[model samples]
Target chain A: NAGVIQTPRHKVTGKGQEATLWCEPISGHSAVFWYRQTIVQGLEFLTYFRNQAPIDDSGMPKERFSAQMPNQSHSTLKIQSTQPQDSAVYLCASSLDSGTEVFFGKGTRLTVV
Target chain B: AQSVTQPDARVTVSEGASLQLRCKYSYSATPYLFWYVQYPRQGLQLLLKYYSGDPVVQGVNSFEAEFSKSNSSFHLQKASVHWSDSAVYFCALLNTGNYKYVFGAGTRLKVIA
Candidate 1:
């Protein structure tokens, strides 16, 4: 299995620009999750989807961050008007279902310059 | 309201020595506990998880964790350390009802020769 696949291993965006990260979940998995990793905040859960529907997004920044899972196979996280503070590694994970072990992808490193 | 905490920000141990990393959680009920390791420039990988049953759970690469309900802790341990084991370890708690994983600040482990 290729596990979860995230595109653009690294991305550099200027301040006020937009950045979009992509993720392809494992086959037959029902849950997809997004997280942001930073030295200061550590791993922060941004959002999650189960059965192609959003469940919780309390961890996401209300203004610039948004996530969508249009289908069972893939999901996207978009950051609009990105700022320097938005620079961090974005990780995507998938699990068979709730309470199951989740597998993570290599992650996309976003650098807002 | 729910959260996980890893007290030690960094830890160093001699090669072949025993190691232990601490983790604590804040939640009303027993949540699904997990230990994950993140190598540099990579995403978090599941090392082990504890749902119910036995308090001690084994993981890949000779890693193990013991869950303590009374203490609200799930600490990871290894009998011997190798240089390759140098990575950041995160403790997470999942509320099966919500399906979101709350992660700790993480502990950076370093094995010295």
Candidate 2:
């Protein structure tokens, strides 16, 4: 079975532009997670959704970062006014439910210039 | 605060040799432990996980991990290494009930022939 699916494996954006990343979780999975990976930060949790409902988003940036799971099938992470510091690989993962093993997508690498 | 630590930033081993990668976690109660591997230009994949029952868990590609509650550690091991085994290994802790998965900085493994 195909694991998680993320669109636009790589994206490039100009400074102050907006960038959106997409993630489609595996079928029947109940938990979707967004993480950012960088050479310096490694992996940082951004948000999570359970049963199409946002369960936690404490890791999201207070200002320009937002994530949404409008339905059970997919989720989106948007970064507005993207800066060079925002450049990183945005990883999307899904799990069967809480406390289960998670499967990750290839990730979308964002380059803000 | 909950955290996962992978002390070794990089570990190099000769081909056909045994391998071990260390991981430690900090949390209040029992937590789900996991090991994920990311190959070059690829997404993360589960190497193994420990939730309960057997302290030693086997995963794909002849990889295994042992959970030690006393030491607060979950370390990944392989009987013999192959060149294909070179990758970044991340240790993670799934917080009990909170649906938060914290990942370590990751250890980059290099198998030299």
Which residue pairs show collisions in model 2?
A: none
Give per-residue lDDT, candidate 2, residue A42.
90
| Candidate 2: stretches off by over 4 Å | none
Candidate 1 regions exceeding 4 Å error are: none
True contacts kept of 2: 0.90
Give the DockQ-based CAPRI class for model 2: high
- Give lDDT tens digits, candidate 2, residues A5-112: 999999999999999999999999999999999999899999999998988999999899999999999999999999999999999999998879899999999999
Report the Cα lDDT for candidate 2: 0.94
Q: Model 1: which residue pairs collide?
A: none
Q: On residues B1-113, what C-alpha lDDT tens digit does candidate 2 reach at each position?
A: 88999999999999999999999999889888999999987889988889899999999999999999999999999999999999999999988768789999999999999
Q: How good is chain A of candidate 2, measured by TM-score?
A: 0.98
